[model samples]
Target: MKEPSPRRLPTGVAAAAGVLLIIPVLALLIVPLYAKKGPQLWGFPFFYWYQFLWVFLASGFTYSAYVLIERARRGERR
Candidate 1:
């Protein structure tokens, strides 16, 4: 009897998930983009508020990526 080969995510799904995961990392890694003191939000500077905003944005991105990967895996199982 032969063993079954491991399934791989489709190229498009993989790429999309990868990009979704990378967006937050890239956004926070580049410092100068949000390194500013103006545009205060409820007394928080742009720099502070910007990072705080990403906390939620990153969560959403991560969840979205996870869902995409899960769906792909489920589809492959069928």
Candidate 2:
């Protein structure tokens, strides 16, 4: 009987995953620290908008990273 090859993570994929995990955590942790008085950028207070903006930024980065990782895995299989 032919044995199936063992699964393993490529270094690049592992590094990408590590970056994806860290960014959001850092964003969350750092946002609150700047939750104080500040000038508005476009009529919105910096304190409020800063945190709000990062929510989208973080989501975008996470989603993009996930897609790239999926693509990489698919390519690896071929």
Candidate 3:
């Protein structure tokens, strides 16, 4: 028996998934937004901590996007 091909997401879902993944990268690229020092977390400056926090958030967003796309692809297949 031949194996079936993997399903693909619709254009809109794919676009949204791309946006979700790209947003964090773009946010990281724009350094000025988080570049600051007034705020501190246990001696960590705003700039340092903000980026560190995003490391977690970015992973979440990426995973969420992956799920979203997968769901969409599955729905289309069904």
Q: Give the best candidate by TM-score.
A: 1
User: Per-residue alpha-carbon lDDT of model 2 for 1-78, expressed as tens digits?
Assistant: 867755566888878877987887786788666677677777778787878888898888888888877887788778
TM-score of model 3 (CA atoms): 0.85
When summed lDDT is taken over every stretch of 10 residues in candidate 2, the lowest stretch is 1-10
Point out the higher-scoring one by lDDT: 2 or 3: 3
RMSD to the native, candidate 2?
2.9
Q: If the candidates were sorted by their lDDT against the true structure, best first, what order would they fall in?
A: 1, 3, 2
Error of 2 at 6 (Å): 4.7
Alpha-carbon deviation at 41 in model 2, angstroms: 3.0
> Model 1, 19-77: lDDT tens per residue?
99999999999999999998999999999999999999999999999999999999888
Q: How well does candidate 1 score on lDDT at residue 73? A: 92
Against the hidden reference, what TM-scores do the models get?
0.89, 0.71, 0.85
**Model 2 pairs in collision:** none
Ordering by TM-score: 1, 3, 2
lDDT of 3: 0.89
| Per-residue lDDT value at 41 in model 3 | 96
- Residue 10 lDDT (model 3): 77
